[model samples]
Target chain A: MSARPQVDPRGPRFAAWVTSAVLVAVLLTGWWPLLAAQVVVFAVGAFASLSAAPYSVLYRVLVAPRLGPTDEREDVAPLRFAQGVGFAFALVGTLGYAFGVPALGVVATAFALAAAFLNAAFGLCLGCETYLLLHRLPGSTRTVSDH
Target chain B: MTGALVALGTLLVAAVVGFALRARDGRVRAREDDTAARVPAEVRAALDAGARVTLVQLSTTFCAPCRQTRVLLSDLAARTDGLAHADVDLTDRPELAKALSVLRTPTTLAVDSRGVELLRVGGVPKRENLLAALAPHLPG
Candidate 1:
């Protein structure tokens, strides 16, 4: 019944692994530029189509081909929301590093890395969990109130 | 040296959290306080349809594992007599989630025909574990 386009579930996990690596690099080097680049990637995936994001492109062009095919497809909304969460952390980390606040930068990137690594390693999507928990919060604009 | 330590610390923390989650996920915990709790009308309706036990799955739209759980539960229900599967979307039903104290998706509640909560699983349940847990309540 859903008209939304579904994506290969593997694509997001692959992207998460790449994101974890990028976050690790950013953390190790205190590189604002690299973190900035990752922020852009997350922004694209969050605001635009997830398939158009850099890692997704890599997944389609390089990784997915080798894995043959997967019948398991996932909705894009949660993944995009997760990308938005990544963008928030990456942006904060970039700002912290660019502004000479290394502590803030380290903390933010570490959090992002933690989330990305969980998705990569255990298929646990914290951002997706956040989305669900957010909906359950009171006064959150949910239309249905009966039953 | 500090950077390496930070990175290592981050990985270690994530690993610990992941392990903890993996251990708890899909575990069915019987609710001792659910002896007097009645299921919602939706689930009670399934019981009225002659099902001895109904597996009520609470799922959200964006939950990928929920799709797999749906497949597993529906198949289980189809092959088993007196067992029904009802998937309730929590996307529009925050009140229901609150009423049931369900904070996560792919949560399965095993309810008897009288609407008592037999047991509940928080994540994607292992097939054998679920079957074993429901064995006493099921006919065969």
Candidate 2:
């Protein structure tokens, strides 16, 4: 009997690139404040994805080694969620900047940069941790650790 | 104006706090194992013939420490002479991780000029420690 080939289907690596392209498109639309916001948002998203090398390493070194084949599915949701948030932030920042709320966009960009630096230097994910804590509030049964 | 500035300041402060907390946790759980493993005969031979330093970094998804280690290793490789670094994402290749027997994120294996394994560092290695480890194998 012929052995079946193993197909690993986890989160898509091109998610960041797609989001970046969208942000660039929005920026090119010629909306002043929105374009500025998009810039900040895109910058944050890029840094977050690139700076997240530590978390990727941890998953490889600690989790994957122990979990085996099935663990691949476990990684998909979290990655997608993180990437989606990045896209959303960029979109919102663009909208805000377009509406003349550049400060909000700047804040978002700063937060993104800080998150990236933190993960790069110390191995921490403020967004993930915050998501977890929010999920733990009364009436919410889903824990951040579930991801 | 003040409100926006305050908000920005707050975000920066939160980032600093988050960074500090993670760093503290990282220091507490940092690994101390540093035994060099035997290199393959061919790899050793390549190193002895003046091959560049080979840096292998093992990492995982959702790991903060792994990211820091990658940056540090990349920076180290760039600054040092005849050093090259490659990172392996354990999430993408479970089999490779198994073959390498990686137990932690940020595990670094340094191969010297003789292609022999010179040192293995688990966790974030101090800049000085990494430099010192490579000093012996560097060409005089």
Candidate 3:
């Protein structure tokens, strides 16, 4: 079996950033339906992250085997962080819904969708990139490198 | 119904997002000119020896779909007789990627024993497709 290539971590990072931003926006906007939408989106993203390996396996069998080996530890950390943040955002949206925030969730959900769009469109992956960049900084670098 | 609608909407959004990304960044086109001659003489010999099926998967690291495909093919190879699956990583070999015209991760190719191409699948192939593809070659 040949070794797989290294894919840029940008995509997942961007996804994380989008998820975070959307959650924040929904909290402020008070759009219940939209907020609900964002929550589902975040969950799907989380699920995708969790079930990543199986999907990769499927790709290898059906598609081209030109894939690179990934740094799983590096990849999983951002995904977990995103998942946590997304869940929190969902909780907030639910509360806002109960309190009659009146479309605050919807607006926030739109923002999240926008963020997701940005990540996918521009390959911005800001969250992951930020983590990686910060991780490379002095103390963090040492910790990551050591591990 | 609401949940299903939400799921469909999300998929549509994802598709549009993916398409926009592709448009902005341009699709990664595999170069078809550089065929790797790295197939060892022994491997070629094995391929020539009535192996009948060559499963070539093109994949990249960090691609979730690629890994899933690999497991499926391995399982299939193990369960089936006389069908051989060779996973070729395209990351290190741009030449092979080009030669095979691989555009996306996890492109699978079904080849004959002599290395002649039979059918090609650009994404994760369904089990039914694989079974149907192999039916003609399977021992009756």
Candidate 4:
């Protein structure tokens, strides 16, 4: 396949910080609506282009301009796959909260928080890492790499 | 009171992760044990002929830092005589990751002439540290 189109690598990490902040809010309050909103955010970000996601838009408008030019572009596929992993956890967590399964909701939200935290703090994309693991899993939902 | 406690707990979590990762970022973890640090035959042979050092970078498709690491190592390899870089795609090669005891993407190993692993960097490597690590093996 032709080379994957490049995007500023910092964009995803910027978005992750925002996601982590929102997740921290969700965890502390145990707020269902906020949880559901985050689930939708992850779903849209994963399935649609990152620009369609809210925090990403903020990054594009506010963060990109302030930062100087970058040659550190990256493939979009992995970012999309990572978003999907985030979406899955978000979906499960939202559902658990909606269905009164507080334990599941708490655990899933905590897990997602941990992943986001890693990306933001350590530049460690647990979602990106898991994409490979998911592909190898027996019943994984990874999108086949078009490349 | 409960809300305050939850906020405190979240902050604690973030702080812990920040501290732990700070300790690892760009730090070189040496593998001086001769027998244990020996490179796999396949990996050793993959090194460029006559090269003294091989920077074998194990990366996955989705890892953003892997791209940066690739460019960094490639540039270093090109500039230095007898220095080679191998970017291994671990997406389909989990076995290799296991073989090298890799814990994450962008993990880079510096293999020397004798097929001994000199050092392994777990995250984005500091160029100064990497250069220092290779100084003994690289010819001026």
Best by DockQ: 1
Please give, for residues A1-147, the per-residue lDDT of candidate 3 as tens digits.
Answer: 335323335445444455545444544444466556655655554554543433233444544245555554233444433443444446465655768763543433443444454454554332332332333345542222221
lDDT value, candidate 4, whole model: 0.78
Separately for all candidates shown, the number of backbone clashes (residues 3 or more apart, or on different chains) is 0, 25, 60, 0
Tens digits of lDDT, candidate 4, A120-142: 77767766655555655676764
lDDT (10s digit) by residue, model 1, range A1-100:
4587789899999999999999989878887999999999998998878889999999999998899887777888678877877888888899999999
User: DockQ scores for all the models shown?
Assistant: 0.60, 0.05, 0.02, 0.32
Better of 3 and 4 by lDDT: 4
Q: Which prediction has more favorable TM-score, 1 or 3?
A: 1
lDDT of 2 at A55: 31
lDDT of 4 at B81: 80
Candidate 1 local Cα displacement, residue B111, angstroms: 1.6
How would the candidate models be sorted by lDDT, starting from the highest? 1, 4, 3, 2
TM-score of chain B of each: 0.88, 0.59, 0.65, 0.86
- Residue B76 in candidate 3, Cα distance off native in Å: 0.7
Cα displacement (angstroms), candidate 2, residue A70, comes to 37
Which docking band does candidate 1 fall into?
medium
What's the ranking of the predictions by DockQ, best on top? 1, 4, 2, 3
Error of 4 at A145 (Å): 7.5
Model 2 in CAPRI terms: which quality? incorrect
